[model samples]
Target: MKDFLRIKVLKMLIPNQKKELILKQMKDKMNKILNYFKNLVAKIRIGKANTEILDDITVEYYEKKINLYHIARIEVNHSNTILIKPWYTKILPAIEKSILKANLGLVTINNGKLIKIVIPNLTEERRKELIRMNTRKLEKAKIILRNIRKEYNQIIKFNIIDIDTVNIYKKHIDIVTREYICLIENIFNKKKQEIRRI
Candidate 1:
């Protein structure tokens, strides 16, 4: 009879412990998704010369494709120009070609030793296009968050927990999803404003 009572007590405790663990895991996953969206948005340029603007450019160096940053030093010379100086003079042509192929709407100057890039000012029409692009990216992020919430909901519903516990978990998941969606919107608005100001 003592063993039976102990077993009943442990069963009651397990549901609460499981609920806590699930909540923590959901929070962690949501945070990871938010961080990723931030990094993705940071790469979008807004009319100024930024080193990260060249991050996506890959140069064909020594029969292998490598990132431009790995083989050269990139610096912002002024509000509108970026200077790239490679360690080896021979790779200058390759770097120039890579930047041109990237098609970032910037002009490149190669003087055989150092490369100078001029970032053009954004026109009103260009600003509108950029804003649209930003919106598209944000929409994609929101979709990913929704998918994550759906998966977690399925997990909670399938478990053999009581109705009250299931309702609580579903509510927690909805709260977390709403919070992350709001964060994404805030980031989008900030970036859109910056692009328009440029």
Candidate 2:
């Protein structure tokens, strides 16, 4: 509220922009929130072979670290296997070592030319843990959306002195926020099912 008041006072001193532009900016921010949430959940392993799980792992290529996918061609050889063929066969050891260092609990088999990652089956306990982690992430995302809605609501309320206009903007913000929350929920539901699929 204090921050809203400060911004309200500042608005009086500065030139006002179109309210539609402010609403558009809020929608853009909400889209970013959803995208970030999707990326966060994509990294969670669910007893299947997904290349995105290795998106963060960096391997040493010519004394400089590079993303695992950049240095190699990663593919899903099977439901439980990820095949990695490095552009340079000599980097097999480095790639294998980097995957091991990541501690993702997968078995890495390095042949002379390529590396195979065998994703292990998720235990019941582990699946539940992953679900809980995803639930926490989902809650955090929703909290962010609510906070953003509150911030925008305050801005609209202070800037537009008319009660009807302020209520309309607040209502629109609420609707958009709910839509994003539903999207986040759908993603989380799909992920939860994946984690439980065994």
Candidate 3:
């Protein structure tokens, strides 16, 4: 209701051309934030056989460090087991060592030909801890959004002289910020559910 009243009081102080440019810039930044948040959530382990967990793990191959997925064929052999078959058998030990060094709390079994990663079931306490961690990440993303909104609002305030026009611009920023925040929250909730499920 307050926002509606403010909009009614706001005059046509700024040209639509300038307003659209500012809005486009803000939307671009918010979309980048949303994409980054999605990437972070994808890395969280959900007690299932998922190859995305190994996205950051790197193996030394011929004096070059390469991502695990680049050198091997990773697949879910079962609900709790990830089977990794390296293109070259010589890299098997290196891959196994890297997995152990990553400290992912997973068990790796090397059987000469391939490596098997057994994802452990999340204990009740561990699940709670993961939920907490997820919540922190969600909060961090929201903070980033708020900071972006603040930066844009400041820009609008400095350029626009009318107080009502400034308020209208700030309200638009708030609406976009809320939309992105809601998107991040939905993703966080889905991940929380995944962590809680057995």
Q: Which scores higher on TM-score, 1 or 3?
A: 1
Task: Sort every candidate by TM-score, greatest first.
Answer: 1, 3, 2
Candidate 1 lDDT tens digits, 1-198:
985674465456546667667767777888888898887778777777889889889999989999988999999999889999998999999999989987567799999999999987799877887888778889998998898899678767665468887789899889989999999999989988888776
Q: Each model's RMSD to truth, in Å? A: 7.3, 5.1, 7.8
TM-score of each: 0.76, 0.66, 0.72
Pairs clashing in candidate 2? none
Q: After superposition, how far is residue 115 of candidate 1 from its true place, in Å?
A: 3.3
Residues 1-198 of candidate 2: C-alpha lDDT, one tens digit per residue? 988677867478423665567768788998999999999888886777888889889998878999988888999999999999998998899998899997667799988889999988888877887888889889999999999999888777666778987887788889889999999999999999888775
Error of 3 at 101 (Å): 5.8
The segments of candidate 2 whose C-alpha lies over 4 angstroms from its true place after superposition are 1-21, 39-45, 60-65, 88-105, 110-114, 161-168
Per-residue lDDT, model 2, residue 6, is 70
**Model 2 TM:** 0.66
lDDT of each: 0.84, 0.86, 0.86
Q: Which residues of candidate 1, in runs, are more than 4 Å off? A: 1-20, 60-65, 89-103, 110-112, 161-163
lDDT score, candidate 3, position 191: 86
